[model samples]
Target: MATAYRQTHDHPKEYFVETDTDTEDSDFDDFVCSDSGKSLDATIFADLEQLFQSQGSEKNDQPGKLLCEVQTEENIAEIFAEIRKEYKPTEAEWRVSNIDERKDHEAASLLDDAFESVSSEVEKSGSIEGCSSCAESVNVLDVSQFKKGQHISMPGKFGTIYQHHAIVCDVKSTSGTKAELELIHFENKDKSIRIRKGIKTYDLKNKQIYLKHYKKQRYDCQLIVSRAETILEDFKMSKFKKYNFLLLNCEHFATWCVNGEEECFQVQGALQMMVDTLTSALGIGSRVVKVVQQLVIMSTDEIAKTISSAIVPEIVLGATAGVYLLYCLAKTAYLKMAYKKNNLCLTCLKITLKEMWLGFLVFSSTSVVQLLIYTFAVPAIGSGVGIPLVVLSVLLSVALKMSVNTFLRVLRNPFGKEKTKLSRPSQLSIADIVAFSYYRLEHVAIVTDILDVNERAQTARVRCIHYGLPKLLAKRQIVEEEFEMNLVNSSWHKFDVDDTTSYACEKRLSRARERVGEKRWSKTNRSDNFCHWAVVPIARWDNYAFEEVNDKEKKNKSVEPFFNKYPGYIAEELRLGDVVDYKETGVLVRKQSKVDQGKNVVEIDLIITSFWKGERKTYTIDLKRDDIHVMYYKPALCISMQDRVERALYWEGRRNRLLWTTNGFIESCILKEEYLDN
Candidate 1:
């Protein structure tokens, strides 16, 4: 059974891979399955523990350090430090372990089903009996001892793999004998954090719990609790959907609350263990010889198919790892150069490690999907687990990758962090830069032009050099009331420049508008016009014009896109007046027919403008090498055209940054300083 997804349906592969997401949707739907309710077999870890003990005995190894009982503060700290190191299998043993941890986890649902089937049969025979409850264990955790704003963590059932973390948000009736304690943590079903009172609402039967402690307080627990509370308050108003089991789960919530950063070392270690095992199993390293020999024996078509699919999780993992390596190295090198450091400072190491782990967290999401697909004995078609797992992976990976640029600004701390004081005038004038903080970074924008919509109301034509998907620059019209009052919820700063220069910039912007507006969509009916922004279209064949050629033949002849990095973006397909994503973007020609020119010859003879990248340059452009594409449809939003959007997309996911120009960074940004060396 095949399911067709709309091309615009949310999917992450569209960013890096060229294949139509619609086609991949069914494949993804078939390949990976996720069941949040499914539990890992406790015996898996029990087996690991048993294996470790047996191996220790076989090696005649001396007894290792046991976990020190947490009687004092030092003992608790020692337990955390030691447990992380103890019973840890070497990479070699882990890879060769009979358990095949990756396979087990990737097909956790299938394995759980199998375990259930066996258990059911055994129960029917009455040979195995079980009874369990934590009611008697109520005295174990002293509610009064655990204070508000303290961390509580629970280990996976067998006490080795995953950990769920939460913070004590409240203590009701502290003087009462049975003091009611409230904890906050992300709940998967709701996709938001919820506060629940004590063990009555939380299951604590089959796991060991830990209370985070330090000899010296390492964090402002009160502030941490405050952040978590704020999140809960905000979430009550909206379902944030920021909770994914693998990436932004409870652990990430807890950590972010405490440290102002999302992190999960347990997830990190587990993924590494899985990757190491899979890499060995896939014959990525030592088994390359075997793979090569197998490939050599295959027919040419088969080999071509295997290489082109790029579906092998291990291979994709390697490629992604390479990309992340360059990403991190470039970041570290640039920061070093910025600080002019010949020696590594503590900050350098800290930033590098931060980037490394976060980048890997996203990278790990990609591999998890691939491995999940590979796990279910992916028939030339259907495979493990199901839609839920792949969807979770897609959401996690895309969310994290999107966060990279946003996070860099926050982590770097110097790029656009301006200390110079600037005030927002009571009334915003043209060419003023407006700054606002959203999510993470400080976003800046220049008011291009102000338009008088009617006698009583006016709108500001605001534009920002946004580093968004498909395009870096974005513009829209906002009512002056909102722009001035509370839309941005931040103040605007006037640009300090000669009135003539500011006036010239204002004209250039008007000229830009006039250039594009001449071809802009006109409302069929005479009604109030609405803000125009890009809307990625669905039903490509219906809206886009393409030569009627065999897709297979076209695939071979296809060249790199000039406007957007999205695949198969042919120049022949673009209609006139369409917004184009380009290096200097964009002055789209207004016409009804397609052009005779190919995308490759795209020569820039003379473009006299002061835009970021297209600064009055006369150069020939080869679209094949550089990225350019007719961005998503941007029919001017009007009373009539608005109907098309509403009729087509029930809800466009989002029509969606921070920086100031005075920080000396904009110059470096425009120069492409990092690319200059290359």
Candidate 2:
């Protein structure tokens, strides 16, 4: 048997030689015999001898064995050529061996000089030139430079091109040329349904490496180091999961490694695209279904056959034209409803038209491409499959076009003008008596203050007193008993005031009125079945009633002059039946009654006459009082009193006695003729 000896070196070589062990030989003779092992047999030794000889001048010998020389480039090339002809290796295997060697050698040469220069500069400056951390230098390309706890990035190819990141846990190098890295990375698969920690080993030459620098300070370095070993162990015991490209991808993992936050910009962008696509698809789907339904309902047997026999180009053109017409009709109907709902002005209508035009332009362009696909490509594939395919293409085309239009709409202004102003028939102000006109409650109220105004809705919030027993509580015996008065005699009451509550109450009242066969109430007009409160500026009456004149001669005038100078005179101390009438002077007053007495009332300034519940009535009021109370008496009950008061006012020619009308009330107590002349 021949003995084989292998030389121990950085690059090892094997040699075989035959020796006679039966004959004893001296050490020097054995060495000489080993030297001549290359010349033993020409055929068997030719290739092996050449391989050893080309290795270099270095030699090693063992007793009764041949010595082998170091390998060199020329001999290795010859051996590689011979091996290539006889035994062919697969591309993967060839890359694993030969390609890896070449890559490692090239990488080492390129990075060695750069690393040395960076190191010298860092040593002098105490930091890398552009990087705060020496380990995160931008020049890092060789995997040999990867240290434990360092974040590294790898460029991805094929399905994922977003680049992946990992943390280096371990690094090993052979002969300072080839490097191996063990890395740990976090990955989420199946749209974040499964989370996985993974560990992988990679040859330096097979992957491109970069030192990943954090944009912000990384404070979790120690935590990363502590968890790395546990993560790697867990990864080795776990099964692989499917990967998602958008929701849970490689970019998400890399960001997590660097900053402990899981985020991916690519995933965010893709999700937004999906949302827009879905919105467009839903819109198109609804329209397409409606169109198909209409077509099915209207189609005749003859029409179906005619459609089937039509050429592909003609069919495509007709379909495109039909879709555009459908869109135009839909848009016109939508615009009509919107115009009625919003009552848009001419400027707003123009703006809406421009927006529609932009959408139409985008749709036209997409339809052209869809027409081509349907005419040329889809027809060749047979109508059975092509019909559904064409429908799907139309859906996608509409979706894409609408998405672009929506994106552009958001980027620019969709509404090019300010909102249109509302036309309101009523004006809200302080101290205006406003009834809940349409609710049929017949509840009289006095406006204390206007709380809020919604100009867009043409509504206002006026704080008021409901004045009588609420319609809800009118039939309840407890309400009458608690106040010790009839439902009609109840004093001021408070009610909640807001748009929603008022609207709900109005709706309920409408249903009740409809069931009762009552006429529908109008907001603009007053009805005998309903009490419509008028806006009365009673402050203007108070100002006109008590006008004080600064006269030099009458500086100290007192109560005695009122009997001589004016027609009306009534005192708080006087009885109700006292003889005091001033009809000729166009001024009339009455004694201050007990009902006008309150802590808020300092004095009764004036008695203003106004129509209440379709009857004329006099109310004693103080200018300082914040709220006034009025009662709603039915027309039948107050008809006699109203007729008497109307006859008296007419005979006295007090036609402008601060009378209140349905829409609004006159503030001045002066007669209409005198007021208009002034």
Candidate 3:
């Protein structure tokens, strides 16, 4: 009877290395058989030969070579074992090393021992085992342990080899010892931040494969699972944004996964460093200033010894250092204030450092020029003349250096274009009307024809027009009633109609006072008498326009009649007439005014003449106001309004109309016929 043999293990086709072999006449007749008194079949040997030939052809193009020599049955078994070992699966395991466990031993030595022991076990048993030692224990984390929505983080390197946090995602594993891990990390690429997901494979026994679980102390596992689902959903749709290392980065993302809030410890550290640096710099500056002052006083006695003496050099050095120190202090303060106002992060620190370095470079250049001027020119002249000349030279050198830098900067761009600081109120230009709304004043007319933007005060100078029917009517009634009462008492009461009209006007004035109330008049008087003109500190401007007001009408107001026209008549004429034109040559006014009482205050009288058939009549309106508020309106608002007006004129054959509501809102009704009624 012939004994039979069969292959025990199945190897993948790709792992088999095929080669050509001429085995048509090969036979295994002399090979040893099992000790059970059975002889192997000849057909079994033929099948083995064909298997080699088929595998050889699959791996290699040649047809007469073998991958390995198979002279004996034992050699064939060894080849199959080698193939099975090569295709064995790997797995991932992790363990936490506590400080107490490794207190008596070195961490590096412990890690080396763990790696060596794991290698020996894998070589002998063909599988990794968990360690029992307290210092080097290993816990194998199975694929089932990590759910789809579980959040895990690992330490990794980002830009310039700086350590950052990376999130683990899309974990996979098979029954074999191997496990696959996909890591998602943020990288600053091409001047922007991007999410990069990468896959890696690890063996269970590999000491380098360590994972840490990120759990929130406040939340339970159920809540964590719920939040994780939402976070993972958001992560899938998240896109790359501009990288701000101190504002948003990988560490922030990882923290956000566990907790709802995003934060980075590295950025906090950087900000703390910036604060310390600024505090130290300011302290050093103060000390230097005091020391320099002492040095200057001490060197005054030795100044006349020689022009090349150490005293003159000390003074020069002290002065230059003092100025540079002052500049640094000021620059640092300005940057800190700006960053705080904008709520920016540690990026401003880097910018502040760069600006300080540039300032130092300029200071050094100025010093060099001063030294050259003193050395070359001071010695040629007498000490009496050279002393003043050297001092002048130092000052002039610094000034010239600064002037040249400014000139170069202006030449480089000429326009001095810069990103506008959004925190600061923008400047308003001439012919811009802003609605002044604050306190008791609601939506008052604040016309800025001769506008002045005071950046220091954060305010603007505006010519305010105050219109009140009750107040104007009261003033006119008082004058006309007194005139009529004088005529009635004296013998000058001419006619019955005139006496009756005067009496009616007096009764109307009394009724108006009673109806409008004395408090309103008293408030209006306080505003007109004491707080007529004001310098208002502005936060910002709301709506703005470049509607042109007739300059001639404003200037000629003082010469026209006062208190002769009714308030209603004046309001109607202003609404109907072309007092506010939307077409004029505009100017960017940058003048600043002093906050003085009764300064830049003007009362204007507007006169409108109308002719119907053969009849001619004139109407006069006196405009005066107190408690005027002003603010800088953004120039962009003016440009936008100007464009809208031009478009409305081209399409609708009319100008943009402005209507002020009683509630203090200025409505720009562009090409709308209905709003003209307001």
Candidate 4:
């Protein structure tokens, strides 16, 4: 047991590791987004980088490729537009897939003729239209360029191979007008997430920096700074979390602060671009490469199969695994080609199935190797004793696992027709797994936030384990999804997941929110339906970590703040009539956030009619949240209002001025467009 202790933990420095050899791209000059308030989506840059890399075959020509070779940003935009035009489901596709109102999931497919046409044209182009010469004077990014709470990326650890991120927090002291600045960042060495001083600040200032800004704001700057401060406080209180490269690294910290989502892309661009370069250089698969198998897995699989066959030729275990894997690979490829249209749910299922099959293949062969090596060679227990002991132990382990699973099933679900009674929820815990059913399947997700503490207000935020298979895969597929709780209904049956990581709930929730927003907004044009829901992702998480926070603590630091409802202009652009949707089809939720004193107090009232499987219910669903950061994107024009009230109270007997009741019977006053304009 001691010898088998493989310290699988990543070296903290691996977070900064990059390719050894420098490419022309090693000097990929960082560009500052003019919009400082815009949400910095690193993934978009990755895609853009991919487009540029596609142009150049050699590494020498790949650096600054997009800016020089691809010509203007217009070419990149044109390509993206082509992708959208070709991929977004048509009316016939959407309706044929589900008239019951399932979210439109785009089918992943082979390079369509539209994409092929666009790619061919791009490759054939002989000109660089808006290409700037290499001798052009570049804008030098310095300390003075960054605004308060602005996200800044420093090029290092190999030029643009990866970037170190930080938030330009504030001035350390007044010191007249020329004050020293403080940057909040995650330091792997100190194992602290906080504001750095003199030497650390000096080191940061010396690095080549660039601003990550977008034209439209994803979140308020004040909100961004406040979350950064909160995370810092948690560190001070002895909740020490080490720097995990794959998990909570520096890139993850800075992005989470700027926007309420935790994403480094798990990426910044250069690292992924390097891998893509290798694939291209090696002449790996082509357009069809984007099919079922992961490229990395596919590249080395034949080698892995060869090794397995050589290792255990007589047992035939390796041969069995190889054949099964080939079958799964073939099946997935066939499914990908077969379901390239209306039945997108089946498409998602195919991907899920591929993962399962691949996992089984790996697990079966690995288990055989591990069992034999550990028993015979390791610890050197005699073959006579080890073989019988290992076999009996395996049988017992299998039986025990089966028994425990059956026991948990009994506790969660009684032996009767499906219905669960309220036993006072044991305790409110963060990142608890929420379990429910998706038709016949048992679906699960990590509970990211506790919406309403009240028993009757049974709604919670969840980050699913790909539980949203039936729904179209959005950027954030079914992540941070809020649904009504009723253990009986087919549309709703849910409870805490049995295995809740006592820690790491904050990371899960943040990632889910970010991904969900990413997926939904990936399209160039956000539709009217996007505005219908107001359930905002709150920035609050368990600090005491659900350890019975008292009433006094609850008041100052609200576990969940009920709605601070007031009738006023929600946004200047949104008219009163437009928000008060009468149809049970969906209910608009709203949120108000402000920093009172130093604490973030968010008021959220989500009377969202949870989009069910066309299930009609008498009661509309309700959910609540705290310290909300998500703000609705103000629409350019207000949606037209129709007086849908079955019965309306005429305001002074004028049809232009009247009152109506929505799905929740919430009375709202509406006036004509003429009056509204005035």
Best by TM-score: 1
Best first by lDDT, ranked: 1, 2, 4, 3
Please name the candidate that would achieve the greatest lDDT relative to the true structure.
1
lDDT of 1 by residue, 100-137 (tens): 53534433444334234433443343222211100011
Question: What lDDT would each prediction earn against the true structure?
Answer: 0.38, 0.36, 0.33, 0.35
Deviation of model 3 at 231, angstroms: 4.9
CA shift of 442, model 2, Å: 61
**TM-score: the better of candidates 3 and 4:** 4
Report the error of model 3 at residue 593, Å: 91
Better of 1 and 4 by lDDT: 1
Ranked by TM-score from best down, the candidates are 1, 4, 3, 2
Show pairs that collide, candidate 2. Answer: 55-70, 55-71
- For model 3, the stretches where C-alpha displacement exceeds 4 angstroms are 1-161, 170-179, 187-198, 202-216, 220-243, 299-678
Residue-wise C-alpha lDDT for candidate 2, range 302-418, written one tens digit per residue:
665655554444444445556655665675676555343222223334545665566556655655565555545554665566568667877677666657545644433212222
Candidate 2 regions with alpha-carbon error over 4 angstroms:
1-150, 153-165, 170-179, 186-205, 208-213, 220-223, 227-257, 263-277, 291-678
Error of 4 at 535 (Å): 36
lDDT of 2 at 82: 34
TM-score of candidate 2 on Cα atoms, chains taken together: 0.21
Cα lDDT of model 4 by residue, 1-678, tens digit: 000111111112212212234345433222222222212222233443453354435332212321221212343343344333434435554333232211111100111221233333332431111110111121222233446777766655556566677776774542211225577776544654443322134321123445665322334566566657655644443222456666666667766665433456535334434433432222212111211122222347776464433323323434444555565577567444423321122323333454446444434544454455433443365445544655464445344433543443333321112223333332435544444565465554445555445454443333333224344553333334555454234343233221331225565454434323222231211211111111122212111111122233212111111122221112222221223322332223333554444222333332322321111122221111111122121111111222412112222233221112232222222221221222
